[model samples]
Target: MNAASPKPVLEMRGIAKSFPGVKALEGVDLTLYPGQVTALIGENGAGKSTLVKILTGVYQPDGGTIVLDGTPVLFPTAEAAMDAGVSAIHQETVLFDELSVVENIFVGHQLTNRFGLLDWPAMRARTRAIMANIDPDIDPDTRLKDLGIARKHLVAIARALSVEATKIVIMDEPTAALSYKEVEDLYEIVERLKGQGKAILFISHKFEEIFRIADRYTVFRDGKPVGDGLVAEADTNKLISMMVGRTVEHIFPKIEVAPGGTVLEVQGLSHPTEFADISFSLRKGEILGFYGLVGAGRSEVMQALFGVTHPSAGTIRIEGKTIQPRTPIQAIDAGIVYVPEERGRQGAVTALPIFQNITLPSLARISRHGFLDLAKEFEITRHYAARLDLRASNLSQDVGTLSGGNQQKVVIGKWLATEPKVIILDEPTKGIDVGSKSAVHGFMSELASQGLSVIMVSSELPEILGMADRIVVMREGRIAGTFDRSAVDAEELVRHATGNTAKEAA
Candidate 1:
């Protein structure tokens, strides 16, 4: 377990890649040895992803070489990379929606019985065996679409393991969508793989996760390898400073502000299958925080309020106007906007241009005589883009190509363009880096300062504590408890969220 070791199982020397103006990676060198987990830590635009793409054959390095198993190898495609015993499980789980878990696991290479037809029994047996090794609870016969995001990810990992991969396994934010219990399960699996002599390249934004799992660590800053050494010898402050090249005084900046009168109210909100009897209120200049375990119906409550899902029973009022929004368009018109938890799915359309995404919802406002006013559109888009400090190829660049933080900015910009009185944010900082998360928090504070009511749903405890003026805890679809800023502690919130305590009414 020492840093000074024999030849690594996989090595990248002087890897460099570039776009038209962005020098994505500049002579970054990484080594992954058998039986060690190497964590690649960096901010959003740092060269971590660039290096991974190069190693996975999604992109060819403009410079440097890759050596696997003591031999130089050139991967022409992703299949070629996998053929050479390297596989990457991305932050976004990519699996066939229409196929069963077993089929997804053995999609490319299926076992045949006698006649060379698709062999279902053999595939099911192997899939079950693989899942038993990693995660046995996932049903092999279930369709991929029916599984939760975390379960789908486990299936992806099982797919990679079914191929008998041995050299290197790269997991990019694999636990981002997982619950606390699921995260522990994933760590256990990682340990098992490490015990089997598999080299793992772990890319994540969570510092605690790296400290717990990583054997060695590398920090990338502005397209260069800024730090590389043993993880045990590194500290959080040092690692964060190296990643962003600055000292972060505080990760969550909570500003003091007075809460105004309630601007939106919900009484006995209930959904047949998702949640029930959830009651809360949001005041102007106040942030209502929702804290609960994943799938505790927090996001579902927000979705029901925003008309994404119909509630079986409930009432919602904005600014003293009782209304049940039948659609998201109506919700927006009613001065309510929802930023969904799945930013990549419900936030922005990646294939659209960044500016187009920013102005997509408010196109009618910028239109004149049934024609789009390009000048006004660009003006509004640039204003928010600059305000958010979004980095992209250009305003016209596809939203998909931008970093995760920038993509999230586009989503926020799109909603802001509507000029809503009430904004609902769900896990707004889920996958973003620390710098971007701070920017988003600042924006939220700024919006609230402008007398806009915000209801934020978050899973991270620190974020809920720092940003919210009032806190709401949900457990199994009901309001477990509510706390004002001065009345709550982390342990108390968790206790109520898990239904361990019933707090008296505020």
Candidate 2:
């Protein structure tokens, strides 16, 4: 526990917010101190973001008192929040794509010369200095569009650095697109920022990350603060349990099935730069779990299998029928569907309504002629929504506004609407709450019971162990080892995944 002696740098007391029908937050309290990172964690719709928005002036709280450095302040706009030395780096980087990194970083606070024109040299120097302060690897001249997602995110943080934000900095899911090396770099930056006595509010779903970086932690559930305090004394397992209000024994709910009838046979599957020589057979009523560390090509292999990426040298057969699917449509036509890991990007059209997102891939089947029949689409959406237990007040709500778990359900609903025999789920439960995770596990089990072949690729070892009848470990784009349900343990899985163990049949 923080001694609770001095007034904290920033404090929110009795914070509350609500929609017309949904209570987004209820009496949430948080305090941020200098020279420490406070991790804010919870299930989706747990009011973590709502609290952040209120702090950043994106959303006005229905009730609360915000005391910053012992002074009550009400931020009416994000700009006002920034002007008061509070800034947030969102999960998705918001920068002008056409602008160069230097220009983007110093946009609002650029150095101007006596002639009232942009000082290119001074701005570039300042950008380089800021990058050096954080990470010298990033180039200032590169256009924001040319940089990868992770780099763009760093650039957004650098924007905060340029302003010398002394009070608080909020980072939302900072490691989502970062490579392992980049994550390390970010940790270094975080350490440096902490030394400067900057109060950082870190938001992430990864327990390992939170454990490694956070000094204090807080949990929110159903838009209210459930737990709060220091991280050193908090148990990770207990924290997850408290966050979801349930004991989470296993994340993977794979059946112990005797695999039969080669449902999907991948022979010599190879994709340039992603993976190669991936050969495996997913049998009917079987859940084959692919486990690997981040960037070990798990999602890439799933994408290749779903025909999102063309295999350079491989033959995929569905029920012994040789199939060469050049596109996702071809894969769907062949009764094979892929529920992508990035639900927001590949799975759901955020702008579209729930019913539209569900029936998008299978609308032709429901339509009589070229003209569409929305009534039939609604029927299908209603059936799947009920079946998946999607928590939406109305079917007309935009899929983007739904919580992570519900959005994931929407993704599954879309693919289930296709009625595919073989379904590939890549990180199916990432960023979702425990309750929603249980729902997805049950749904997967039900799908397998219906004799649907499932191949789930996940980074979480528990999910793989819990759900997979057989686990396949991959390393550097090759099948490292295969383990039957009873044979594999977490250590062995890690060994195989990290290329420490040779190809062993278990």
The model with the greatest lDDT is 1
Judged by whole-model lDDT over C-alpha atoms, candidate 1 comes out at: 0.87
Q: Over the stretch 1-506, how does candidate 2's per-residue lDDT look in tens digits?
A: 35553458999999989989889998989999888899998888888878988999999999989999989999999888988889778776578999899989887667889999999998888899989866688888888899766678789888877777557989998876665567888899889988888899999888889999999998988887788877888887889888888877765554555657888898999888889898899888888899887767878888776778888998989988999988889999998999887788888999999999999998788888687788898999999999999988899999989988899999999999998989999889877766678789988988898789998888777778888888998887888889996888988998888767755678
lDDT of 1 by residue, 124-211 (tens): 8889888886678888999999987768878888887777754789999888888777788889888998898899999988888999
Candidate 1: minimum summed lDDT over ten consecutive residues — where?
A: 248-257
Stretches > 4 Å off in candidate 2? 1-6, 111-115, 130-135, 495-506
Instruction: State the TM-score for model 1.
Output: 0.95
Backbone clash total for model 2 is 4
After superposition, the stretches of candidate 1 with alpha carbons farther than 4 Å from their true spots are 1-6, 113-117, 501-506
Q: What is the lDDT of candidate 2?
A: 0.85
List TM-score per model, in order. 0.95, 0.90
